[model samples]
Target: MSPTPIAWQAETVPVAGIALHLARAGAGAPVLVLHHDIGRPEPSPFDDALARSFSVLAPSHPGYDKSPRPDWMRSVRDVAVVYQWLLGERELTRDLTLVGLGFGGWIAAEMATMAPRAFKRLVLVGAMGIKPERGEIADQALLSYIDYVRRGFADQRAFDRLFGAEPTTAQLEQWDLNREMTFRIAWKPYMYGATLPHLLGGVATPALVVWGREDRIVPLECGERYAKSLPRARLAIVEGAGHFVDMEKPDELAQLVIRFVNEA
Candidate 1:
């Protein structure tokens, strides 16, 4: 298979008193991507694909990667607020699409609920933030990154592309930092905000909820719950994919995203 194209430029953009390392590319409408817990601060194949049609903004969460995390930054709500400030500071509040995956999806959902009018389109992929009435959202905190990948992807090759057979020492340290940040933000509520579902009904932004039919991490049930809670949202389940749908099915996810963003 050919390598995924690399076109984005990595740079640091100051936001909320600290600098955010982000990858930006493309030239049309803006698309902000809030990455998952395991995602790094750099652009991925998914970002590259989205950059073909839209300007992709993928930022490292405050506490993750090289970004400095303020002591006060604790919950997903806090993260969401910081992002709102970031968008406003950059004047990107209008005609923008917000895409979130896994933990990032949780933050994106919170942001949507907080502003309701900030984004033109919203996409959540295997998002976490709502407590399942029946099953449970898998606790990735307890699992090793390798184990997490194995569980998150239907195609094992996807894990190799993202994590490799063995992580370097620096990679391990970065993974630990990312995992620690994940704990700080998600451990309290165990990944769900008690009030998020109630608030989602007020979000009028059109949303597309994507999930891997066999996602063991967040589960399809959570996606269904998001679809039901959001006032205007549709759920799409990608068969043979897992929690890491973006990595496992970048082209497919990008197509869904483009279609959703283009719709009236």
Candidate 2:
């Protein structure tokens, strides 16, 4: 038989008065896939792997990718509220398996902390939310594309295949837009908000905290602290990986998620 095609679709839904673009795949229980700060809701290997077992719903958070952005949208918490609205509009309030990556993971944590009962489970991969007591926060916006590619990947060959060529004109334009919006909201504090730590302890959902052992952006210790604070949480460190652990170790991450959600 021919290969079974991945049934993926894209559309816009109204969230916080702005239309947010969402890409979806598969058919089953709903799993929301949140993208990293410098990434969009594209068909990443990690997303593809997860889609094999879940109805994956990946949305370009308000100002990222092609989503419409309003001037009023500011701070990571605002992004979380938009996602909450997105789930409400789509009728995905209950039984949500939220998988957030990098900055998206921060948004996921905020969402879960805000409404602990809404999500059944949460998976944060290389998440950035909790403050590091010692190390200075890494400014992602200041890094060159090559710098990002190197820091995010453990395998150079895989990096060449995924982000090798210079970005296309359209991609460059979108990148510019994403960078502008990211700076507008997240530049002031560098890594986290003042009140995020206080809010994190309130989350009641089962959490799977995945960290890249070599992550430079959000240190592994942050993941340890995040897991320690949550009532039901486990921390998994992916070896030979950096900030983008999901991209570098998709299969391993997928297995962890499958096991966590399946058990719950």
Candidate 3:
């Protein structure tokens, strides 16, 4: 349980007339890390671990947290386009790996579907966007703090480490704003689409779908469905983990991702 030693630099890249905040570290092949609906990209343990071996970039999606949002940019497609622009601005055109968690995974899937050749590999962890036959993914914005803590993690102690104890007023305010933006974009279908099946089959990049065996928010069945639809995809279930598997099981999750990237 030593604190991760990776050093990250804060960057602001202009995309679609707004300055987007991005956290970056390490070197070698580029790996982009997308945060869940919770946002606040800096404290991500999974990104830190991945940065040890690869150049990792974690961007705060427009309208989330400290990132500015344009009035016209609505829908997940808009977010995906902005991310693509950001990558272009950075000149990351080859050997790109996109890894996303929860709602971020939805954005990643959309990005891959829109421009599959832009990325070399895709990793979706506890992803949402594809509609399931039964039950619905929980709208994260509506969940109370206690409810989020209970449903998001397999180990409750990981909550204090990820969210921290006695968060400052400013931190809480940012968290609220992040949740609001997430709800604004994702609340319509309760975090899914009926047309996702058609789009998923079109993604050409190799994909890795990682799900927590105990995930209640987005069921494990959804992960299986996502893998089955994609032409090049594999599914892995992490036991003793919930929706936020990366936080509760960072070491295990990192190992899985590293192996996948190497294999791909």
TM-score of each: 0.95, 0.93, 0.93
Q: Write model 3 residue lDDT over 28-85, tens digit each, in one string.
A: 8899888887774456678888988899988888988768866676677778888888
> Over 4 Å off in model 3, which ranges?
1-4, 165-168
Between 1 and 3, whose lDDT is larger?
Answer: 1
Taking every candidate in turn, the Cα RMSD to the unseen true structure, in Å, is: 1.6, 2.0, 1.8
Candidate 3 lands at a TM-score of 0.93
Clashing pairs in 2: none
Best model number under lDDT: 1
- Residue 169 of model 2 has an lDDT of 69
Scored by lDDT, model 3 comes in at 0.83
Task: Using lDDT as the measure, name the better of candidate 1 and candidate 2.
Answer: 1
Q: How many backbone clashes does candidate 3 have?
A: 0
lDDT by residue (1-264, candidate 1, tens digit) is: 875576778788787677877778887999999988876534377888898899988888987986877666678888898889888888999999999988899999999998897789999999999998888888877787667768888988777776776756777778788888888878877989999999999998999999998899886889999999999999999998998889889889999999999986
Candidate 2 TM-score, true structure as reference: 0.93
Name the 10 consecutive residues with the lowest summed lDDT in model 2.
158-167
